[model samples]
Target: MNLADTIAAVATPPGDGAVAMVRVSGRRARAIAAATFRPSAGKPLQPRRFTHGFVVDAATGTVVDEVVAAWLPAPRTYTREPTLEVTCHGGRAATAAVLQAILRAGARLAEPGEFTLRAFLNGRIDLAQAEAVRDAVSAPSADAVAMAVAQANGSLSRVIREVRDPLADLGARLEGSLDFADDGVPELDRGTARAVLEAAATRVDALLATAGPGRVRRHGLRVVLAGMTNAGKSTLFNALLGSDRAITSDEAGTTRDAIEEILPVGAAAIVLVDTAGWRPPGEMPVGEAERLSGARTDASIPLADVVVHVVDGTAPHHATAGRERIAALAPGGAMLEVWTRADLHRGLHAGNQVAPGDQFRVSAITGEGIQALRSSLHARAVAGSRGAGSDSGGELLTNARHVDALRRAREAIDRAMAVVAGAMPDDLLAADLRAAVAACSEVTGEMIGDDVLERVFRTFCIGK
Candidate 1:
C-alpha cells in the first residue's frame, strides 16, 4: 500500500510457458531494475525500450536468469508511474528467482490487484474499467470477452458519465436557485428539470436491461439435466458434451453426485450439470449415499437457468412420472423435455403431455436427433440470455455491482421524478438528484469509499 516503495510480482500465470513477466512499479521501479538487472550490451536500461539483460542477485551478484526487460517512464505507463517489466524464461523457478532478486533489491511484493489499483488511483482508468479488466481476463466465451473488452475500453464508463453529468448539472442548478434567491439569479424551470431526470432514468433503464444477458455472458448459463432413475441422463449428457464426462450404467443411482462440465453452445457457454435420477423415497429402498445424491439433485435443480427433464423414450411410465416431478420441482425458469433412447422408440409416447415444440426425442447410442437436441438447447440458452432484451451489440452491464448501483440510481431518479411532479421544494428535489448523481458516481468510482474499492479489487488475482 505504500506508494513510495517499489512493488514487484510475477504478472504471468504459474507453471511452465514460453515466458513469464516480473512487474515492478512505483517511484523506485527504475532504481530496482538498475540494481537487479545487468544489461548485456553494457548499457543502462532505456525508456520505452526492451533491453537484453541478466537478472543478478543484489547481495551475491550471481546470475539469476537472463531476461528481456523494458523500462516505462512515469505519466504514460499503466500506473502512470515509473515501471519496469522483466520477461524471463517461463517456469516457476526462473520466475520466482527473478521476483526474489527484485525484492532483495528493495522492492516489496505487490498485493492482489495492487497493480491495477494503482492504475485506478492514478486516474488512468475508472473503477468500472478496472473491474472490466478482470472480466476480460476471465471471460468464459468469445462473446463475453467482447463485452468485457468493450467495457474495459470505457464503453460502460462513457454511458455512466453521460447519465451522471446532466444529473449533477441539474443538482447544481437547483442549489444555485436555493442559495441565490435574493441575488436575482433565475429560478430553475421545473419542466426542464423533469425532462432531464426522465431522460437520465431512461438511459439507466437501458443499461439495466442488459444485466440478465450480461450475467449470462460473464457467468455461463446453468443447465441441469434431471429425470427418473435409469432415464439416460448421463448418456445424453455425454452426447451433449461430446465426451464421457459422466459415467453411465444400467443400475439405478449409479451417479451418486452432481457432475458438472462447461459446454460451449454457439456463442454462449452452458454449465451443464448431470445429477442423480430422482425417485420418491420408500418406492425403492435407498441407502444414505443415494439419499444424499437425491438431495444434491434437488439442490441443483432450482439454481439452473434451464432444466432439461430427461425421460426414457421406451418407457411410457417414465414420461408421466418425469412430468409430475418437473411440475413438483417448479424450476421457475426455462424448461425442456428430452426423450432419450429415441432409436428404440421412434416417436413420442402416449404419456408425453408436453407440446411438440417443447419436447425433443433423441438417442444417445445411435446419435439420432443429437444435433437437433443440441440446437434446441442452444436455442434455450440464447433465449435465457435475451430475457432482458435483444442484444443491441453494444456494451453490457455484466458486473452485479454495476447493476446494483444503476438500480439505486434509477430508484433515486424515480423519486426525483415524483418530487418534480408534486412541485416539491427545490431543496427536496436537489437532495434526490444529488443521491442519483452519487449512485452513478459510485459506478464510475468518482465517489466511492475505500471499503468498496477493497472489496472490488481483492477479487483480482495477485500480480494483476
Candidate 2:
C-alpha cells in the first residue's frame, strides 16, 4: 500500500495485437528503464518524450527486443511518478519478454489494480476518481463510458464532496447546539436548522433516486424474456444473441432456469435473459423448474432495464393480454411486447399487437422483422437509467454500496428531523445527525473500514 515504491506491469491486455504496453511508475521507474533501453535516436529517452529503442537485457547487455518508449517526468504523470511506457510487438511471448525485462531491471511486478491503487495511495486522486479508473476500462456501453469519464475527471467527486461537506458541517452545528447551549451561546435557530436539513436531504434524495438507473447504466442493461410456455422466448433469445445460447423445444417447461446471453448492444452490451414462461404450479411433477423459474424472473424483474415480453401469437389466447404474467413480472411498470412466429398464420398476427409503447411482429423461423426488433432493443438498452430522470442535470451516484449508505443516512436524518420537531432533546438529535454523517463519510473514504476498501478494490480487473 506504500506509494513510494515503484510499480511496473504490462498494462495492455494479453493476446495477439499490433502493440502491447508495459507501464512503470515511481521514482526509479525511469532510471531502471534507462539502463535497459538504448534509443536509436539519442541518449536514453528525454523527459516527456517518446523514442524508438531496443530493450537490452541488463544481465548480458544484449538487445532482446525493439520498442517505442515514452517517459513522463515526475509530477506530470499518472500516479505523479516518473513514469515509463514501453510499446512492444503484441503476442503472448512479446508481453512476457518485455515484462520480464522490466522486472529483471529491478521494478516490482504490480498486483491487480495496483497502478490505480498507487494513484490513490499517492495524492494524485481520491477514492471516487480511483474507482472511476476501473469503470473507464471496463465500460460496457458508451453511456457508461461517458459517466465514468466524467467521474474520473472529478465531476462526480466534486458533487459528492459538496454534498458531504454540508452534511458534516450540519453534524458539527447540531453538536454545537447541544454543547454551547449551557454556555448561553445562541443555539442553531429552528428555521436555520430546518433549512439546512431539508436542503441536504433533498440533494441526497435526488442522487439516491438516480442510483437505480445509474447502476443499470454502468452494469449492462438486463432485458428479461418472459411469456407463457412454448411461446418461443428461447427462439428470440437465440436469434438476438446471434447464438444458440438457449435450449428451445416444443415441450412446455423446457427452459427451467433463466438462460442468459451477453449481446453487444448499441454503444454497450446487454444481458438478454430467456426465462420459463409462467405455467400453473407443477401438477405433473414438471412444475418445480417452472415455479423456480417464475420466482427468479419475478425477483429479477424490478432490476430490469427493460422487459421483452415474447409470445407465440399463433398459440391460443390463454388470458386476455397475459395480465397475470404482466402483473407478476412488471407490476406497476411498462415493457416491450413482441409476437414471435408472426408468419405462421394471418389470423395469428392480427390479435398479437400489444399496442401503446413498442410492439413488434417477428419470426424466429424466417429472418423477418428482426433488424427492427434489434434496433428497438438497442434503444431500450441505451436509454437506461437516464430514461426516467431526464431532468436532473448533475452527477449521479451509481455505486450500490454508496446508495445503501445514503439511504441509511437519509433515514437517520429523517429521524432527526422528527426528533427536532417533537419531544426529543437537542442532544438526541445530535446523536442521529452524527450517525448520518458517519454513513456519508463511508462513501468518500473519510471514516471508512479496511473491509469496505478490499471489497471495492476486489471488483477491479487485474493490472488496472
Best by TM-score: 1
Cα lDDT tens digits, model 1, 1-464, are: 78677899999999999999999999998788878999999999889999998999988899999999999999899888899999999999999999999998988999899999999999999999999999988877777777788888898898888889999999999899899999999999999998999889878878888888778888778889999888899999999899988999998889988999888988887889999997733367279999889888888877878788898887767666666666677635567888898888777764445667777888977898778878877776676666354332366788899889989999999999999999888899999998999999999899999999999999998888
lDDT of 2 by residue, 17-72 (tens): 99998898887987888788888877767787789988888888888779999988
Per-model C-alpha RMSD:
2.3, 3.5
* Candidate 1: regions farther than 4 A off: 280-285, 350-353, 386-393
Q: List the residue pairs that clash in candidate 1.
A: none
Candidate 1: residue 156 lDDT (0-100):
86
Question: Over 4 Å off in model 2, which ranges?
Answer: 1-4, 174-184, 228-230, 242-259, 262-269, 276-303, 317-326, 347-358, 387-392
Q: Which 10 consecutive positions of candidate 2 have the poorest summed lDDT?
A: 347-356
Clashes of each: 0, 1
Please give the CA lDDT of all the candidate structures.
0.86, 0.76
